[model samples]
Structure formats: C-alpha cells, structure tokens
Target: MIEVYTDGAANGDPGPSGAGIFIKKGKNNYHYAYPLGILSNHEAEFFAVIQALELCRKEFPEEILSFRSDSKLVVDVIEKGFTKNQKFLPLLQKIQEEAAHFSFFFIKWIPEKQNFHADKLSKKAIHLNKS
Candidate 1:
C-alpha cells in the first residue's frame, strides 16, 4: 500500500498558493512542493489532491492508495463522492479520474498538527512563489 499526505496553502483568500505532497511506500518516500500561481485556499487544497493522485498514477499505478489531507472540505467531498459547489466540479472530477487508475483509493482528514510536514512544505512553496 502507498500512503500520501497532501496540503495546500494561500497567502490570501485568492492569492499566491502552493501544493505539497508527501508519498511513502514501505521504506521509500518522496516529497514535492509546487507553486500554484494565484488561487483560493479551497482551490489549492483540491489541486493538491489532484497533483498527488497524478503522481501516484505515474509512479505507482497498481498500488492501493491511502490519502490524507488537512482540509476537511476536500476530504469530506471526496469521501462522499459529491460536491455542491459548481466551481469545484472540475477539480473533483479530475481527482476522481486520477483515483480510478489505482487499484484502491481512500481519503481521510487529519489534523493540521498531524500533517505538519506537508503543511510546512506548502508554506515553503508559497514563500518561493513570492520571489
């Protein structure tokens, strides 16, 4: 099984943002910090999940995936397999598409404290975007 932890952050409600992904499989691990120009915090969170799903598809397509995120909205929407917000339809669709590639996929919400590593990486990406 592969475990993925993802987080997203924006300096403002609709400001410079970033997505952070941390992947672990057995003893191996991978980390990514990506700058996402300017987006709302919720958008960034959805993007983070999409980015992580793409990474897993590319690197570990056959493995079962367990995804963790600090965003309750993202986790809940994904778990429920639906979203009422029209703006999030595309993002949710992309996430579902990517997740379909895996043998099994699960997403859950974690406290920010438990997701510190990914959160820090996202903040770092935000700082990089400032330059």
Candidate 2:
C-alpha cells in the first residue's frame, strides 16, 4: 500500500494557489508541488488530491492508495461522491476519473499538525507562484 499526504494553500481567497503531495512507498518518499495559478482554498484542496491520484496512476498503478488530507471539505465530498457546490463538481469528476486507475483508493481527514510535510510543501508551492 502507498501512503499519500496532500495539502493546498492560497494566499487569499481565489488567489494564487498550489497543491502539495507527499508520497511514501515502502522505504522511499516522493514530493510534488503544483502551482495552481488561482483558485479558492477548497478548490486547491481538491486539486491536491487529484494531483496525487494522477501521480499514482503513472507511478504506482494498481497499488492500494491511502490518502490523507487536512481539508475536511475535500475528504467528505470525495467520500460521499457528491457535492451540491457547482465549483467543486468538475473537480470531483476529475478525481473520480483519476481514482479509477487504482484498484483501491481511500481518503481520510487528518489534523493539520499531523500533515506537516504536505503543509510545508504547499506553503513552498505558494512561494513558487511569485518566482
């Protein structure tokens, strides 16, 4: 099983945003930072998960994925497989599509303190937008 920790951050609401993903497979670790132009915090959070799943599809296909995120909205929306917010519908669809590539996919909400690695990466990504 592969463990994935994801986080997203924006300087302001609908401001420059980024997605960070930290992956652990056996004794190896991987990190990814995606600068997402401009998006809301919630949108960025969703994007982080999407990015992580996409990476898994290419690097760890057919592997069981256990995802952790500090965003409750993203986790709940993904677990329920539904969302009334129009902004998230397309994002959710993309997640579903990417998730299908894996045999097993799971997402859980974790405390911010427990997601330090991804959190730091996301903050770093936000700075990337300036450079």
Candidate 3:
C-alpha cells in the first residue's frame, strides 16, 4: 500500500499558497513541496491532493493509495463525490479523474497534529515562494 500525506497553506485566505506531499511505500519515502503562486486556502488544499495523485500515477500506477490530509473539507468533498461550492467543482472533477487511475484509492482526514510533516513542508514552500 502507498501512503500519502498532504497539506496546503496560504498567507491569507486568498494569497500566496503552496502544496506539500509526503509519500511512503514500503521502505521508500518521498517529499514534495510546491509553490502554487496565488490561490485560496481551499484551492491550495485541492491542488495538493491533485499534485499528489499525479505523482502517484506516475510513480505507483495501479497501486493501492491511501491519502491523508488535515483538511476536512477536502476529505469530505472527495468522499461525498460532490461539493456545493461551485468554485471547487473543477477541482473535484480533477480529483475524481486522478483517483480513477488507481486500482484502489482512499482519503482520510487527520488532525493537524498528525499532519505536521506535510504542514511544515507547506509552510516552508510558502517561505520559499516569498523569496
């Protein structure tokens, strides 16, 4: 099973943002922090999952994937397969598409404390983007 931890942060509600992804498969681990220029926090969160899914598709296609995130909104939206917020429709669609590539995909909401690694990576990306 491939385990993925993801997080996103923004300087403001709709400000500079970044996505952090940590992937673990057996004894291997990978970390990625990407600056997303400017976007809302929710957008950043969705992008983080999108980016992570893309990576999984490239590196671990057809593998069982378990995604963990600190954002309940993202987890809930994906689990429900829909969202009332029209702004996130495109993102939701993208997520669904990406998820279809895997033989098995699961997403869970974790507490912020349990998501420190990805959270820290996201903050570091924000700082890097500022420079």
Candidate 4:
C-alpha cells in the first residue's frame, strides 16, 4: 500500500495558505504543493486532502491509498464519520463522491511534529504564490 501524507498551513485565520502532499511507496518519495488563497485554516485543511486525493487519482490510480494528515478536520470527517460544518456540506459531499473512483482509501491523523515536511512545503507554496 502507498502512504500519502497531506497538510495545510496558513499565516492567519483568513490568510495566505497552501496545501502540501507527500507520497511514499517503498523507498520512493513524491511531494507536491499548491498555493491556496485567503481562506480559513479549516478550509485549507480540507483542500489539502482533496488535493492529495486528486494527485493519487492522476499519478497512482488503482493503488491502495493509505492517506494521513495532521488536520483533525480532514481525518475525523472521513474516518470517524463526524459531521462537517454546514457551510462545507456541498464540498464534502462532492469529495466523497469523487473518492468512490479509488480502489482503496484510508485516512489517519498524525502528530504535528511528524508532519513538518508537509508543513514546510505548504508554507513554501504560499510564498510561491505571493503577488
């Protein structure tokens, strides 16, 4: 199974943001980052998971995906079947629908320190997108 780790970072509540993803299979490592505009940290966190899944769909299709993230919102929403914020219901539903295309999917929450690599990538993404 391939393990994919994702995280998001923001400078403030509604500030410069980014999404980071790192995928590991065997000894191979893959990393990606995408800049996000002004939004709540929670929104960026959800975007990170979506971005990670999209990457997997394109690059690692048909493979077993074991996804991990430092965001409690991302992990709990998908894994524990917790209720999502009402504002995000539509997006949450869309993401869930798209995920059906995957052969396998799993999400876990990890400690913040363990997610530093992705955190750095996310911060870099925000910098790259600065105008």
lDDT of each: 0.91, 0.93, 0.93, 0.82
Candidate 2 or 1, higher lDDT: 2
Model 1 global lDDT (CA atoms, 0 to 1) = 0.91
Order the numbered candidates by lDDT, best leading.
3, 2, 1, 4
Question: Residue-wise lDDT of candidate 2 within 1-131, one digit each (tens)?
Answer: 99999999998998999999999999999999989889899988999998898889988997899999999999999999999999999999999999988789999999999998999888889889989
Cα lDDT tens digits, model 3, 1-131, are: 98999999999989999999988889998889999889899999999999999989998897899999999999999999999899999999999999999889999999999998899888888877888
Candidate 2: residue pairs that collide:
none
- Clashes per candidate, residues 3 or more apart or on different chains: 0, 0, 0, 0
Reference-based TM-score, model 1: 0.95
Q: What TM-score goes with each of the models?
A: 0.95, 0.97, 0.96, 0.92
> Model 1 over residues 1-131: C-alpha lDDT tens digits?
98899999999999999999988899998889999889999999999999888888888888999999999999989988899899998899999998888779999999999888889888888988978
Winner of 1 and 4 under lDDT: 1
Better of 2 and 4 by lDDT: 2
The pairs that clash in candidate 3 are none
Supply candidate 2's per-residue lDDT for 13. 96
The 10 consecutive residues of candidate 1 with the worst lDDT sum are 121-130
Tens-digit lDDT track for model 4 on 23-77? 8999999889899888678888888888888888888888898888888877878
Error of 3 at 24 (Å): 1.3
Query: What are the runs in model 2 whose C-alpha is more than 4 Å off?
Result: none
